[model samples]
Target: MSATPPPTSSPELKRVVTGALVGTALEWYDFFIYGTAAALVFNRLFFTDSDPAAGTIAAFATFGVGFVVRPFGGVLFGHLGDKIGRRSTLIITTLIMGVSTGLIGLLPTHPAIGVWAPILLTLLRVCQGLGAGAEFGGAATLLAEHAPPGRRGYYASFAQTGVQIGLVLGTSAFLLVQLLPEEDFLAWGWRLPFLVSFALIGVALYVRLRVAESPVFREMERTREIVRLPIKDALARHPRNFLVGVGAHINDTAIVYTLSTFSVAYATAELGMSNHGALFGVILFALTVIVLQPVYGNLSDRVGRRPLNLFSVVFVALFVYPYFLMVDTGVPWLVWLAMMIMGAFGFAPQVAVQPVFYAELFGARVRYTGFAASRELGAALAGFSPLIGAALAARLDGAPWLVAAFLIGTAVISFVAFYASRETKDIDIADIADIDIAGIDPVRKPVAEE
Candidate 1:
């Protein structure tokens, strides 16, 4: 009998990449706008009349709520992705995120409904969290499964590009709102950005709906090789890889959140910048990150994942303290430069390469579940780091060093965990399913009778 040939890459790969990038951009735009709102306006609107410090803390705590619920969304969506298909899961997540974001724009403020305002806002944020938890995993899997051999990193990095674009749009929109009169901005202008999400979500749905299912997933379905319980199988068969994947993502999550979301609160509350100035710095940083992610991703293709990822971590450890020192000087341009460099060059490489690295860690059978669970689990730690940093900032009298030290510690943990992982740069996607152990051993153990 003749052997069956491996699936070949076609124009479909381009379609999948385009769909993933556009859909993810819209989803993240919705998610990121919420973060920007929480950092700036949500507190005053929802927590009205509280102490400023206490309100900021409460606002960020609600931001962290989304991160807390994300893991559950990952599990739920991951199961659906592995069992049914990536296309449908992507469509569902985008709708959920869009609807929740639109609702937040129309929600009643504390003045109108008192305590129910924040409570309803928290409920909507949870819905956003659930949608986001699954969105990245599905997009990454869709791109990775369709990419040609030896170029998965290049193609998968496109999803990260969507993330950068989303951040850019989200922050830029908020900056635009900052230009409004103070009273108008607080009363109604802030809600305009959230309302804008509906138009972007429509674009995402159109793009995603046209893309076909991943070839690898279709093959698995045709062969009746889909795992009956993907999450359980992933846990049992790939515990070490899952742990490594989670650890590898720690720095990316922690540092990105710290530099972007937490920095807004830190600057306005602690460093005495106006809300507009703080958000403007974040907008500048987001633009740099958007430009640099694809470059770093292509660099990873040449240098391999471990070396580039390690380089990023080491740079983050060395630069975070100095960056904070510059920010503490209270010079607007210096703070902007520091944030731009930290986000663009210091943080981009790790974030750019991680989707490929994490996707490569699992086989086709459970790629969605493994990637979703591991990445979301790591992100949950990051979601809370801002709250932890806020608490520490209160005790330290807004000393930036404390937050820097905490970020560096997390980076070190990521570096060590990544160092211990097996390299998958040259492994074929089809063959990944067979790599059940970390290394080869010649000795075989006898099966014991149960």
Candidate 2:
């Protein structure tokens, strides 16, 4: 076995977890602001030429464009992360996302810039996508590598929990902005949230700079186990594991987008509810996620990740139809209840453990690349979910049945992927090289015995 560094200090572990939490929170806050804007304002602001339905489709398409560029970002930064170090890659991604988001707040509307408005918007969205592509994987990998053996799931989950906090901040920001008059809101009020994101960047940078580098990566460098091309090594050496990570990741992105982004448009535009009401529902659900994700992650350390993940996917598949039914009622209480059930209960478990689950799939040499590349590739399927949901609703005479079915299909794909993969909760990070990429071993036993 390679000589792993001594365990991270207690205070240092706290600092590292705090940095991961703060940095990801700020980055996702920027990302989520765009999603909120795409649903609430972008169609009218950027795609004015099309009818309302067509405009929403176009706007959400731009949202998906970010996802399109994410895999590239993952490959680019994942390589740097694997080669150089996690700390530096994180700082670079933070600056890229922060700058792109701040610039978006300053962009002129279609009426002012004509065609250039959307062209610039798409370009900036690409930058945002690239930045986001590396954030989760990097954060998760860093935290998992730092965490103590039995508590990796709990520590790694803080990254995603921070993301949920970002969702709450972003949704709440929009809710506050939604209070303005309709004319002013459509004109200038919507830019406030994006503009405020600049301050968050400063705070995130401060926290991130304070944290030490991942001990696992340092040990790799000390032991000279670092690979030349992490992406190539990950693919060539671990194809099955990479594919498994991709399949396991699809539903996490798809399900979240369906519940949060598309449902915002579905509730407001199609159901005739107010944006305030929808944003409120989103805020409530996000708050629930912040509280539950860690609990679920901690639970996974005891019960195992596969059962929780499988249960969550199956639960979402079953609940999505009724979830939409509640939304269509135009009653705020029912919608809130439905979102709480879906987000806090059904969705939280998968998301809670996903970071650790993917990070655990690879050995130290290619962990960053394997986790980032595969997860973002899966994100490509999810990136267009809101756009697809919009189209499905339009095609079905404004009903959400087809959209719900599509969500169920994605869930099943993820379930199958998780079912086929082996559990890694008990695997030692230092000894991971003893296991093959396909999760097979002649001597070492599987973590979870059936």
Candidate 3:
């Protein structure tokens, strides 16, 4: 029999992409706002009375708290996503993120609540982590499952674009608060951005509600083939793919967290840049990311995933040192240049194509579980890179090179991990699940119905 032709796009494709974008944007807005708060307000508001350095460390530790909870979120949500449907899982995650972030805006400070202030803050952060962990994997898998065969990378890249949109909005909000009087900004202005998330979340929920379920998922449901134990199946059948996905994702997460979140503190504390100056750098880089995501994603469609990902890893290794040097020079324009290059060109390739690449590592039955688990595992490592970098910087007496060395080591590990995996560019989506763990050809078998 002739092979089944790859599916073509319909009006449904547009709807799926729109849903992915809106939901992803809302989730990331929630995530990025916490990072902004950690940099500017959390140190003083939650960790008061500690030494300045200790306060900063404590605030960042809370930031990492969210990352710590992600893997459990991935497992919980991934199971539901694989068994129930992607559309429902995404909507649930969006609500969790939106509600948690809005409540953070309304929370009372340390003076009002004493030690309970940081405790409440950390608890909310864990909720944010739970939502964020599930959101990206579902969105990416939904988009990829709906996309036409040759354009999965291009379509799925919109999910990453949503992340850039969130960064733009979140960082821009923080920058706006900087314009207020210091007393006003510290007292009330910071709360404004968190409160505004309510409106954005409402809009995202409306848009997402209108989109239909993914066609591939629908077909699986029709065939009664949805795996009941997705995580177990993924672990048993695709261990190598899972490990490789973790490795490929680590460097991308590290670079982004370092540049956007950690850099704010690093620039101010070590490089002697003002808070406004560091925020401006973040804004510039966020804009660059917005512009570059689609370009690199489309490039992956043309050239391939392995080459582009490898190039990104190598570029980061080479660029981290120079990037820090430029930032340390305290030249505002040079800092802008450095951030733009790092965000737009250095990190774009892997970040843009990863949704499609990582999702494709497993078959449709376990795509959500495999992708979510591996991606969060990788991010777990990255989640700690900043803390490590901070400690290394302290030990080396504010030496940026030491941090650069650590980032380079992460890049090296990622490169080796990805190098060991099979390229999935031309593989048929339905056939991906049955592929061997050792990167060999699939042992062709009859397709099973749910």
Candidate 4:
């Protein structure tokens, strides 16, 4: 392997990272607003015919529907991303997600339009899934491919940070709307969060359109390294890496859904907490991730991605039960503390490193497809975690132990995958596609000679 790095000037790096971050934030903002609504408003608004518990389950099922369509999104956009360019695919995805989310604001309720309300809501959610499927993988790929060597984790962390910022914005919007009179909040306030996505999409487009395509992708095309069928190439050549990516990502998705979406519904409907208290706790914890994620990502550059990933799953396994134990106490401080620890400390570190971590597993030819396909497949399973948790709790007479056990099981799956994977934090970007497993060293490599 040549001890030379890919071309990534500082000025280009800044512009690319900023574009990735802003675009990711907007896409996730649109996506998360649906999750928040499914928990707080959709059950009552769209699924009015069912009893309360059943209604919540149905609503969360719709939320999961978005995830179900993500792999297809990844397949569709990843192909375009590999064949055409990341910048263009991302532009189209932003429009799809933003327009779909905004249209959701205009959807009628069950009382007004009957079953069509939920059906239309589900269709919009699918559009969200389709766009999001390609959104993160492409953004992460763009940022990682443009980042300075030895700092991929630090730079790519910005994409995950954008995701947390989106959650914060979505939850905060709900919190603001919840302050209105209950009837009014239910009638129209729920639409505000979805409608605001139109403006966010505009800002994302402005920044994203100006940023250049990933330097690495341009290099790949120049060298004729772009494959005709990237997903097929990825699965055929790097099957182990693809499987590892799926296994390694599940805990992050499951845990986040449990805390941000499921916990809100569980707190409000089951635990008898006010919506404001539940949303406040989530918003507070999500805000901490914006700070903690980048720090952990930077740390991974020095310490290696494996140790932190292992620590994340282990932490989730040991703490999942206690996290809920704290939530059940009904003290706002205790709930917030648990959320902070679980989200900021446990989950943040895993995701902070994941974008680059997964991206590094494949060669440039199939990185986008490999990353998106594997990650979204994992997300599909974890997306229904809230509904699963609710069903488990409902079946067990409102006890959360069954749900906690399910989370621990997911952690174990991720832990084994992380344990088996080779660390790539220090691998040269040019060599990563073809680097053998035996060639990978967990310790940082010597810096390439200038």
Against the unseen true structure, what C-alpha lDDT does each candidate score?
0.83, 0.88, 0.82, 0.87
Off by over 4 Å in 4: 1-6, 434-450
Which candidate model has the greater TM-score, 2 or 4?
A: 2
**Where is the poorest 10-residue window by lDDT in model 1?**
441-450
Error of 3 at 244 (Å): 0.5
Question: Mind giving the per-residue lDDT tens digits that candidate 2 earns over 1-450?
Answer: 266578999999999999999999989999988988998899999999999999999999999999999999999999999999988899999999999999999999999999999999999999999999999999999999999989999999999998998898888888988889999888899999989878878998999999999998998888787888998888876677788888887887887777678999989887888888888998888888889988999998998888899999999888989998998898999999999989876779999999899887777788888889999999987789999999999999888999989988899989998997778788776656523544476124356521
Error of 1 at 422 (Å): 1.3
Return the clash pairs for model 4, or none.
363-433
TM-score comparison, 1 vs 2, better candidate: 2
161-264 per-residue lDDT for model 4 (tens digits): 99988888889899898889999999999999999988888999999998999877787777666789989888876777888888988999998888888888
List RMSD in Å for every model shown: 3.4, 2.8, 2.2, 3.0
lDDT of 1 by residue, 1-450 (tens): 011225545777778888988988889989888888878888789988788777877888898999988888998999999999999999999999999998999999999999999999999999999999999999988888788877878889889889878887888888899899989999999999899888778899999988988778888787777888888888877778888877887888888778777888888877898877877788788778778767877777777888888888999999998899888877889889998889876788888888788888887788898899888988887787777778778888877678888898899989987897777777666556623454531012113300
Ranking by lDDT: 2, 4, 1, 3
Which stretches of candidate 1 lie above 4 Å from their native place? Answer: 1-10, 434-450
TM-score, one value per model: 0.94, 0.96, 0.95, 0.95
Clashing pairs in 1: none
**Could you tell me which 10 consecutive residues in candidate 2 have the lowest summed lDDT?**
441-450
Cα lDDT tens digits for candidate 3, 1-450: 013334746777888888888779777988998888887898889899788778877888898888888877888899999998988888889888988898889888887888999999999999999988888999999888777877888888999999888887888888888899989988888998888877877888888888877767777787777887999988888888888888987888878778777778888877788888988888888788878888887888778888888988999999999999998887888988999998876788888988888788887778898889888888877886666767777787777678898899889989987797667777666556544455445323235511
